[model samples]
Target chain A: MATTETVAGAAGEASQKGMPQLNFATWPNQIFWLVVALVIIYIVLTKIAMPRIAAVLAERKGTIGNDLAAAEELKSKAKAAEKAYNAALEQARADATKIIAATKAAIQKDLDVAMAAADVQISAKAAESEKRIAEIRAGAVAAVSEVARDTAGALVEALGGHADASAIEAAVSERLKG
Target chain B: MTVADQGLVIDPMHQFQIVPLFGGDTLTWYTPTNQTLWLGIAVAVISLLMIVGSSSKAVIPGRTQSISELLYTFIHNMVEEVTGHEGAKFFPYLMVLFTFIVTSNLLGLIPGAFAPTSHIAVTAVLALMVFLTVTLVGFYNKGIGFLGMFWVSSAPLALRPILALIEIISYFVRPLSHSIRLGGNIMAGHAVMKVFAGFAGVMGIASIVPIAAIAAIYGLELLVAVVQAYVFTILTCVYLRDAVGEAHH
Candidate 1:
């Protein structure tokens, strides 16, 4: 307690210590060291720190710019490839249409030739049948004339009066005509 | 222990005391004091963040690297925007200023730590450096025509002289306000925290209120620390416009 009281008394007595900031006694020391510290900081900054940071920043910017440019190039290349693909697809479609039209025309030509040959064969067979029919009619006329003559002669003989073949033939012929 | 045992003998200003680090009652200009130690700490912290943090030249940034880049770009854009294209040249110097001030300000926030930025000696040096650079650059770039910034041709003929006087006065006051603004804000916040801590020392169980106030004020001081640095940097850029950019009334 005595020691504490004495220390407090000493502090109270020297309470005139005033503002230490106004004490010009230490200003020189403070200024000296401050200038030294500043010079050191300035040297470190200008010589080392500032340049390194700037280089890093600039390098980053360059890398980013290069990456962006490369991306843009790839994008354009992809667009060109897509365009070529579409053009090829369109060309293939046109070729298919042309091939289909050519095939249809070829099929039509073959069908036309087959139908014309069939029509010629059918007309020739009809002509031959007509000729055969004509011949049969002629043969039938001859046979009928002969039968009439025979029957007429037979009748004459039965009636005790004979007749010639020419007369029978003439009469049969006249009746057939009628 | 002696001061603590006294309980209510709260000397808030005692925190700003710059005693010699080694055994001595005298402080020469070269004396390594607490101010020197903290200034060195600020420089080390800045070097750690900027130099070591950016050692990895990753195409993709990691945590510390990204933080370094964030500060770099923030100040970079600020300089470009405020001072136009030509101001880009001073980016490294401005980065130094910003990093130094902010680091000093924040390091001072530690319990029982000395704040170099809170001292007028340090902030005044920084502000004057900016002021000198701007003045020298203005004269170098524009010659005597740089004085046209004070002429204020945009004003009417009768008011031109009056506007010029005001411009000149405000122009000269830049360093004063710049230094004081940062030093004052930091000193005030830290001092206020100390005062509340003194209350906490005396008020027994009710010390919680003062403790809470200190906590809240510490948070404010943290904001103030970064904000004052930002203010200092941006003001540097704004003043730099007079040198590098075309004269605008």
Candidate 2:
């Protein structure tokens, strides 16, 4: 066992005496490979991978920006459309009011013309009725005079006295005048 | 009993040895090693994730695509937050650094797999590259005023020179600490797990203790893997912020 241990210890010492990592000879090789690896990685990243990733990111940003801009534009357009619609609605209301006023005035003008014609007809009918009333009053006066003259003649005859026609007519006319 | 007493010798450091793939007696610089194999695998996996997974470019992403996109956005936001909007231009580099380091660290966690980050060689190169880039960018952008970062304008005139010297030393030490921090943490975590695994081999049914410890340490190492990657990236951003002269100080 002691001999085996000694042999094992000797072997371990032999292996551990000079670590290859500490050897100055192989550094250039490792460094050269390192630079090669770094250069290759740099090329891959800068030329191929990074640009592709940047493109994707840029595309996403651009899409978002465009969507936001379009939304803003649409919102403004909708607002303008609403404004124009409101303005048109206001104009329509004003036009309707003006039309209503004009129509009312036209109707009022027609009403005034009709009222004037009716007034003329009513005045003419009133004048004709007034003339008839005057004629009726004249007839009533003449009939009353005739009735009194006849009544006076009858009364005188019955009383055994003669009544002169011209004298009785004159007496009825004078009494009617009184 | 000692590990050797039970006829079991546990060499925790054995896993770090670099062996030639084709059974060559001596490893040349151009020889394909385990490091090369795993590094290739990591690169391929990353490529598969970032490229082929999103090949369809569906607006609604699948799982792999979602992961890639999440990593992209996460690192992108980090750069933006730490380095500001101007840092956007450097985002690809930051993305590459983050994905590579994180993927390498995670792949290393697999049992019997090699962690490239466990070696100082790989991490030092990464750190040195960042340090050099930041220094160059600072000088390029700020010109002579880049030295103003080291000069302590806020300090008393007598203390300014001493403070400036300290700042200069700290600035130069940045790469050393940056490289070692990641490599050390990863190496230590793996080494400790291996040590515990070695103990489990000799303990028979009582191996439950080391097994439980291994389980717990593995969970911690997994957290460390992501956290170290984050720390490394954020520090890079901070350095970048200074380089771009965006620091309020």
Measured by TM-score, the strongest candidate is 1
Candidate 2 wrong stretches, greater than 4 Å: A1-14, A68-178, B1-3
lDDT for each residue of candidate 1 in B1-249, tens digit (9 for 90 to 100): 026664666667778777667745555677778888898888889999988778998999999999889888899999999989999999998999999989989999999789999989889999999999999999999999999999999889999989999999999999999999999999889888888887787888999999999999999899999999999999999999999899888
CAPRI tier of model 1: acceptable
Instruction: Write candidate 2's Cα lDDT for A51-114 as tens digits.
Output: 8877776776788899999999999999999999999999999999999999999999999999
The TM-score measured for candidate 1 stands at 0.81
TM-score of 2: 0.72
Candidate 1, backbone clash total: 0
Model 2: interface root-mean-square deviation in Å = 8.6
TM-score of chain B of 2: 0.96
